[model samples]
Target: MIGALASQAPANAGSPAVERGQYLVNIAGCNDCHTPGYFLGKPDMTRYLGGSEVGFELPGLGVFHGPNLTPDKETGLGAWTDAQIVAALQTGKRPDGRELAPIMPWHAFAKLTRQDVDAIVAFLRSVPAVKNKVPGPFGPNETPTGFVMKVVPPAKPK
Candidate 1:
């Protein structure tokens, strides 16, 4: 199923690197969390990788939305350099010196080959920029303004 999806490249996705990246992004399930309306059974392909309207709520970490990955300067990764993107993927550290939310699986991505990582970056760079600004990385005490999928720990047996 993923293979079929990866076969259809985005309009701007050209070059070997971009294609490879698109494939990687699809197979890696980047859309599962990043694309808006995805968790709600409707993925907005028009705003692909443009960030999610829903957030994830960890017990003590508060809610975090899947941020926009498109290259829009005002609301997405446009200002981030290739190195910054790579670092965020591999190290779970944002360029602004903040650690990525725990929901982000950067540890697994850390094992990706350098070439693969570079390809992913290329693909991300080539996508059409979306102007969506996903909501917060709200603090534990703060209230989130959007829908959230909470992750609750299993209860201990008494």
Candidate 2:
């Protein structure tokens, strides 16, 4: 399975690291939430890994936005070091010391081999830098409060 996953990487034209990273990101479904329009069934490859406005809302936990993974200096990972990237993936802690929401699946990502994680970083670095500033997670103050539930009775047996 790992072999198959790696094979999906792009051709190692300039850097084998970047190719492997692209492949890993694809198989791991990183674009699903990080890349806008992915869930809508059409991803804008031009803005790949540029983050998304549509975020995750986990009620009491808080609302989370997928941050840009591209190398944009102002709004992305351009300022992040390779070690920091690896740390984020393995520990779910951002460079700022804040914890990433569980919706990011950092726990599952922590299981990835070191080489794979490095590849992801390399690939992210190689992409074109997009100046898109993703909003931070909305805390309880900014998020809406309340819950709604509906119950239905069971149908009669035949």
Candidate 3:
């Protein structure tokens, strides 16, 4: 079911498309996982988009800090490609070669239109680049577990 939806939409990187994507990301909980922040007892608003490290303490796995989505050359996705952004949002992957932690909910967003996801990337690119280097979280039992969580295939236009 997910695979069929994954191939339906082709994300186009245009001005309006990007803007729409931004709105979707904002309304949805994309920032909750992709952005760097720790919601321990209290929401870590300071580290917005910064990954969280509380994934291990309570639930099943200990999550890491979300990275800044701004176009900062160093600490953010400034270097990521629009396709990469779409893939990450639609497929769950890092621009480089790493699969984003499962905490980054791509499945739900996968249902969004390609234009909407592109809009999100567009909006993220427009954000002020904040210099913050984020590290990957330790996998469950020291073994990578986000792989199975990467079940998001793509999205189908509603």
Report the number of the highest-TM-score candidate.
Answer: 1
Please give the ranking of all candidate structures by TM-score, highest first, separated by commas: 1, 2, 3
RMSD of 1: 1.8
Candidate with top lDDT is 1
Which candidate do you rate higher for lDDT, 1 or 3? Answer: 1
| For model 3, the run of ten residues with the poorest summed lDDT | 1-10
Please state the error at residue 142 of candidate 3 in Å.
5.7
Q: Candidate 3 lDDT, tens digit per residue, 1-158?
A: 22322221323434576556555655676555544333434444444454444343213554445666767677777787878888888778776678766556778878878767767777777554567665546554554333222323458889
Error of 1 at 52 (Å): 0.3
- Best-to-worst lDDT order: 1, 2, 3
Per-residue lDDT tens digits for candidate 1, residues 1-158, read 45535544666665888888998998899988988888998888878889999999999889999999999998999999999999999999999999999999999999999999999999988888999999998999999999999999999999
Query: What's the TM-score of every candidate structure?
Result: 0.94, 0.80, 0.62
- Collision pairs in model 2: none
lDDT of each: 0.90, 0.74, 0.57
What tens digits encode model 2's per-residue C-alpha lDDT throughout 1-158? Answer: 34433443433437988988887888888877777555566666667778876666665666677778888878999999999999999999999999898788899999999999999888888776777766657764574222211123568999
